[model samples]
Target: MDGLGFTVDQMAEAERRGRLFGLAGDVLQWSGPPIHTVQSAADELGLSAEEVARVWALLGLTVTGPDVAALSQADVDALATWVALKAVVGQDGAYGLLRVVGTAMARLAEAESTMIRAGMPDIQMTHTHDELATAQAYRAIAEFVPGSGT
Candidate 1:
């Protein structure tokens, strides 16, 4: 029962229960000031609607709005964290990070299976030597620009 050790069964159960976010519960406790709208929340902290959407999906929450006008602050903060992590992946261009995020996300059971989905066309094209370096650059911009709060 040590804080750091979990049996495979325990980990599997956690994954089944969508407890990946709760794994970081100490850091994720609701200690910040309240936020009411998604856009304002994103604006206050610097995030994008797309980033927010992905985070909400990860946290077992759903956003129901036609636009930025209908978003909650809590959702925004969580989205910010997701954006940060995603930004890191893009910055490094290390597929390992992408795999880690995808694995963690898989445990959350929130999003679709990324492996089944295709990689970015740019990545695919570059992977085929169509434009490899540009593929990395394209990935960095597409993912980080929205997530980095820039």
Candidate 2:
């Protein structure tokens, strides 16, 4: 099967094994430049396959398309930043981060593809992960903000 198909298969396997909740990215060993295998991405980020899969599976959408052959370096970096933010934020942190980053990442991917479709504009979704990480941190703090003793 092609790379996108293979990625779906891997995701299914992860879900079946119940490791989907703890996916760590290195489960696939992807070597291609743009298409990152789960295992390879995990290794690159010093994360476990289980952790990567877990985080990945939490997304409401499935990643597909030629542009999604491998996790772009930019996306991979963003995911790593999200994970690091998760460290200090924990479960609630993850919830907020996922909600925000997941949507932003999706938009960023769309924009990237648009650029590619529009003759490869020099603009790219860079450092979005950092922006996502910051958003998560802010959300965590917001949760604690005093609210009229509601």
How many clashing pairs per prediction, in order?
2, 27
Residue-level lDDT of model 2, residues 1-150, one tens digit each, is: 123234666567656865432222222322224667667778888888666666676664444432334566765787788778777788687867677766875676576446443552221223233433433333333343233111
What TM-score, over all chains together, does every model reach?
A: 0.30, 0.39
Misplaced by over 4 Å in model 1 are 1-34, 66-75, 91-150
- Name the 10 consecutive residues with the lowest summed lDDT in model 2: 120-129
**RMSD values, in order shown:** 16.9, 17.3
Model 1 earns a TM-score of 0.30
Steric clash pairs (candidate 1): 37-71, 38-71
Regions more than 4 Å wrong, model 2: 1-33, 63-69, 103-150
Candidate 1, residue 58: how far the Cα is off, in Å: 4.0
Q: Rate the local accuracy (lDDT) of all candidates.
A: 0.45, 0.53
Model 1 weakest lDDT span, ten residues long? 21-30
